[model samples]
Target: MAKKLIAESAAAPESFEQAMAELAQLVTQMEAGQLPLEASVAAYARGSELVRYCAAQLEKVESQVKVLEGDMLKPFAADGAGEGMQ
Candidate 1:
């Protein structure tokens, strides 16, 4: 298989969930070892891309949570500030 073809699979996916699922399916198919040489090669390539997409999605989620956590939380105000102080 051409390395360039495999490189395309390493690119990020548009939908994180679908990409992760596809990647997992690819892994299962590989484990089965029933695919032809060409199909196996293509799956390997696609799996790499899905992995990249999944990792990027996770990183984005973590960054967003961190940002929210770092902010000073405010009380609901309507709750009459019964909660703890900031």
Candidate 2:
């Protein structure tokens, strides 16, 4: 069962949202503290892999955005204040 869980999660999804949803589910189940020790371990491992996958996806997008912006990446501000802001 653990192997199967790991195998299923090993396949990358077409979208980051899908991976995040699945990762959230795994986290919920693991946090519930109802799974056997082996299953918990498997879930944790899958979660770790999902995290790495998500990070890679984000990094790719960030790189693309930077290229589109001519590498002039600006810091994001929450108070409506930053570079290029009036």
Candidate 3:
């Protein structure tokens, strides 16, 4: 079980979207209560790893956005008219 989790985490998704899709699938499987105890534990561990990876990716993107915005993070406008817009 540990080996499988390690392998899966090592592979890690290439993109945040891919990771999120896999995590969603894992959540659905776990919620169904069909997996045995060991399998469930493994899935939980993998899901945790995915969560961390997704968060890190988000933070990286946010940092890039801040840099593009001159280090000033602005609130997004719901109507799509925000900073840098005429």
- Please name the candidate that would achieve the greatest TM-score relative to the true structure: 3
Clashing pairs for model 3 are none
Candidate 3 lDDT, 1-86, residue by residue in tens: 43364456657789999999988888887898877788888888888989999999999999999999999987778556775866
Against the true structure, what is every candidate's RMSD? 7.8, 4.4, 5.1
Better of 1 and 3 by lDDT: 3
TM-score of each model, in listed order:
0.62, 0.76, 0.78
Q: Give lDDT tens digits, candidate 2, residues 1-86.
A: 54566567778767889889989988888888877888888888888888898999999999999999899787678566675856
Q: Show model 1 residue runs off by greater than 4 Å.
A: 1-14, 71-86
Enumerate residue pairs that collide in model 1.
9-49
Better of 1 and 2 by lDDT: 2
